[model samples]
Target chain A: MSETNSPSPMRILYIEDNPLIAFHVEQMIEDLGHVFAGSLDSFAELQKQFASLEMDGALVDIDLADGATGPQAAAWLQERGIPAIFVTGQRQVAAEHGDVSLGTITKPVSSSELAAKLELFR
Target chain B: MNTIEDKSLPALDQVLILAPYRKDADYLGRLLAEHEINVRAGARIDDLARMLHPSPGVLVATHEALTPDALATVAAHLETQPSWAEMPIVVLLDRASRPDQVRAELGRVWPRARLLFYQRPVTAVELVSGVQSALLVRLRQRDVRDHIAQEVELRRELNHRVKNILASVTSIFEMTRRGATSIDAFADDFRGRLGALDKVHSAVFHSEGDTVSIAEIAELTFDPYRLSGMDRIVANGPPVTLSREAGTTLALCLHELTTNAIKYGALSHPDGRVQFAWNLSQDETPELAISWKESGGPDVEEPSRAGYGTRYVRSALAGMFGQKPVIAFEADGLRCEARGVFSRVAGNQ
Candidate 1:
């Protein structure tokens, strides 16, 4: 909580398939005093722009535009020393890939829950 | 129908006559042919096995034709028959042959066959009628096989549809809860969104095939407002049909827009108004254009950051149309417009 209160906010990238849910979660992320680092619909797109994306953490959904690649994307991010969390409706899927993320925030995500889980990234 | 025929069971109207004696083969083939019953003769045991490849409707065999080799070949063919098939074998016995012994031996050899026994010097009328009845039974079995296949296909389609609907409901619940401010607000908004989804689902289901008209989507979205007698919102468009996916997306988008309007934009004030219109171009590469405009409301100003409604409109439209939509927050109103290839938006009709 102290780290979140610092002058600079954490930049969080979103990986989700549905645009409506992504946008809704984007606003929630920003409302929790974090910066929205933009969103990618699939793991392939994230790979394409992984180098240029300036983000401190990532919020991933289990399903993506290109199918079930979110867990793989989180693993890829973890390999780069970037912190990630599962922001998905599929709890079972997230639990299966639990080792790759800080924690799971089930959808529809609440403001307080998101604000609390984001502390782990700090 | 042509594809059905291509994969259908073999033509089952013909009768195979296994009469090793040349005179008997000629006489029987001629008699059956005169009665309009197609007949093929097997002069050797090898010919009987070869003819079984394209199974005949019935087999007419003379007692003399029942050599051990011929009987074995027929038994093998009967064993390989599909569960839907029961090859009809009509055996003509010689008067000197013990009928009971032959019947018992034949029954043991052909376990699943329909055996019709006729004594020698039998009437043409009785033999022809028996063969005709056997052919009718084969047709009934074919119908049952076809019906079972159709039911299997329908069950698969139904399972797929049920899974998709459950996923959709999950998405709606998640998204609705994300934007609620209070418990009461959450309940109301969730119910409204679910109602919208349910309405659109039924519209698509009842429509011919997997498509629905644009007008139907618009009407359902605005029905609540219209029933409340606040006819300030007006939507007009050509009769454009959309795939189930496209129609559902549009319906949800309109729901978001309608809710936003009532909360902050045109529909929030008595003097305000909103206009929604769309048209399809006739160019070589046909395109569809849709616009939403709000006016006569309190002075408008862009929020410091896009809210859920505005953000959803841009992102969802971009995904559906493969192009970014133009959304402007002017001093007097909010305006949004988007255009894309007609085929892309409508999907493969």
Candidate 2:
């Protein structure tokens, strides 16, 4: 791994039930010169760990281990002044709660798209 | 008269009377009311238009009420009705009226209506029975409508599940490819994971409430190892059902553990043994604890490099239980255990 090209380094937390997808995205965030915070599966887990979680941005999936509570988790983060982006296959679901998110990056995410969207964290 | 239901659109139990002759309309309406049947009587063409919107169970119209405007309104309403609905209409004709010609004309005008004709001097018993019969048929049509709606909802639910499964497979494929050292290794890993997923799906589908018991998952997960002319794995647990998500995560984790054991742990040797068990602690929170222990195999030492199986077991269990699992590579064999609140993954609540 080489350095000296990143503009800003941000720790990104991902909320997804599928660990495989989470792992892939974890590597993607690292590849983009950003730090991977951690992965939580449900909104319930998010609430429990919210106060202690250190992250500049959050990536969430519309459906989680608990159910379809991704939009609610994003709103929870938004209320605390922390920004979030929805990385999900359920684009319509993400759009319905678009006000709580910076934007959406559809699933089977490419590095270029994620890197660009993470830039909107500020 | 009192109304049974205030539905603006009439239900299958209400009758509508369209008679131009006020006397005839009053007579029919009074007769139906005496039978305790709901009746809506209208004389003007405007009233007929308004009444048509509230699809009545049976329409009682006098021969004189079949004016061009009245016929057009009924015909238009019938045209827009759902395929399952055929509006019932009862027409009172003069005794001298040519029955055959009237029947043919009415059939052509209201193509989808169930038309029943009665002579002018018809008896009360006969008219009442006829209307009762028509209402019965309408009730059955309503049942059909409800059944169709339920089926549509079931189809939507099935479609949603199919999409979620596809997304899961895509994730598995990409992740398995990431750690593959060779093409053969990739195929074997993908096939094994997919089989575990498919078997868990079957277990969940067969179980009531879309939940699979921990015992069933163990039986299915450990069946292959037991079938190979030896019973090296012993699984024991009380009846504890988990939601589809939790059951799937558990099943896949078991697969990774079992395969690792066969490849490098207890099951790798001829005299090897594996013990799998789970318990719910008696407490306010009722934390569920599951453990896998092995012995009588080659000396176990932590591998310097962790592959997809080890990494997935850690990440998936942590996500599912809201707690990370402990994996120990002891001298005898490998041991793994995780404990979390029972309520978090309980099914059908």
Please, what is the whole-model Cα lDDT of each candidate in the order they appear? 0.81, 0.86
**Considering every candidate listed, which one attains the maximal lDDT?**
2
Tens-place lDDT per residue, model 2, A1-122, is 22326678999999988766786787678767889888998899899898878999999999886788999999999999889999998899999999999999998887778888988996
Tens digit of per-residue lDDT, candidate 1, span A62-88: 877667899999999999999899987
lDDT of 2: 0.86
TM-scores, all candidates, are 0.67, 0.86
Q: B173-218, model 2: which lDDT tens digit per residue? A: 8778877889999999999999999999999989858999999999
TM-score of the A chain in model 2: 0.94
Which of the numbered candidates is closest to the native, going by highest DockQ? 2
Clashes of each: 0, 0
